[model samples]
Target: MRYGCFLSEPQGPDAIAGLRDQIAQAVADGFTSAWLSNIFGLDAITALTAAGVQAPPIELGTAVVPTYPRHPAVLAQQAMTANAALGGRFALGIGLSHKMVIENMFGYSFERPGRHMKEYLDILIPASRGEQVDYQGETLKANVRLTAPGAGFPVLVAALGPRMLKLAGTVADGTVLWMTGPKTVAEHVAPTITAAAAEAGRQAPRIVCALPISVTDDPAATVERANEIFKIYGQLPSYRAMLDREGAAGPGDVAIVGDEDTVLARLEELKRAGVTDFVGSVFANRERTRSLLIGAAKG
Candidate 1:
């Protein structure tokens, strides 16, 4: 099981250089991959492009960029360019973002997002392969081709529900999961994704599980910090259902917290649950940096 690190672009007045240094350190520490979140603060693709230039040999990717914000062809071009800039080490992870963010913030209709994503992939995959695509779906339409061959960048989908997982299996290289626990992964996620791949006669899709980690003797405090970090996700119904299935009272309840032994145990549980990769978001303090500690564990 490969272990990786996941972090957002740093938050502060002057954060770019600091963020680059953090990415460099993760690469130097031998992490298999490093991911950036696609959110309001920073442009993930740009950050990753800069990080790729500074940190050679580290796999860089977005955990996801929302599909509603950009057309599939545009996203394909951006991803191809980034993958080339990164020397063919970039994975393009895309998703249909939350309805709240899309409908309220971006003012795009969020209904039938799964269908929209499926149509998006119909264009995106072929476009990434440098093929001409003439696609017309209810929500999207495109007739485009890349002028040059893409870097053959792997596409991962941010999938949670059944329909989305099926689309990922049919079209994408893998799935990137957030806020899901080992038990729920074993009982729900892995089975659904694998079954879909099998029905399609495709190879089993990669299952990259993103889980919060905090190596602390005071597990309660660590959970508190995780809750604070993930408070917004708790309010979203999609994520809330996943949390409930994992027997979590809230988002923090699924977080990997405790001493080193306990944290390692949680990680092993994920591995046993058929996770192809583990992207850990380490929450730590001034006294004990969980990122450094968990990075060391990869060795």
Candidate 2:
């Protein structure tokens, strides 16, 4: 399994131009990918392409781009364009963001999100493959063909539960998870998705796990800070269910926070538990966390 990291807008000059140096740092540190979460600030794809133009050879992925707001055709065109710009180094990860975010923040009804996702992917996957998708579905319609030269890269879905897992298995390249622990990946996420992929005669799907990482001498203090920063994740229903399945008290409970030895062991557990890619969200002692993860990966 390859190690990766999430690069947010750090508090400095690179914040506005995008963290190209950080991306280079991650690459130099032996990370396979540098992830960007699609949130309020700069658009992930735009930022990724801009950075990838200058940064060395390292994969770039969005933890998720919300599908509720953008149509599949628009997303396909955007992905194709960005992938072309990055010479197909971009992996498009999209999802139906949590109901609270979709309903309350975007003002879109989060009714039957699974079905909506199915409809969205019906057009998205084909469109990404350079096909002319003249498709109509219950929630979406796309009549566009990608004329872009680059073969579009992989599409990883941010899936948590069974339906989405099955969707990722049959259609998407893989599943990208957040706040999901080793236990859930071993017992729930991997099994369900793998079974679906098997039944469909597809290869076993990739499981890209995202979780907080802190290589700290003061583990307790680090966990406390993780709880403070990531508490909101536990309140989201899907994440709450995942936490409950992992028998976790909250987001911090599942986070991989410890000294280097403990963190390395936990990362091994994740790899053994079926995580194909580990995206570390460094919450404290950033360089140490990255160095330890890279060292563990080398080992």
Best by lDDT: 2
**Model 2, span 127-241: residue lDDT tens:** 8889989988887888888887555689999999999999999988899999999999999999999888898898888899999999989888888899999999989898999
Residue 121 in model 2: shift from native, Å? 0.3
Which 10 successive residues of model 1 have the least lDDT summed? 286-295
lDDT of 1 by residue, 70-100 (tens): 9989988988888888888888888888998
| Cα TM-score per model | 0.94, 0.96
- Cand. 2 TM to true fold: 0.96
195 Cα displacement, candidate 1 (Å): 1.7
Misplaced by over 4 Å in model 2 are 11-18
Q: TM-score of the candidate numbered 1?
A: 0.94
After superposition on all CA atoms, what RMSD does each candidate show versus the true structure? 1.9, 1.4
lDDT values, one for every candidate: 0.83, 0.88
Full-model lDDT, candidate 2: 0.88
Q: Which residue pairs in candidate 1 have backbone atoms (N, alpha carbon, C) closer than 3 angstroms, thus clashing?
A: none
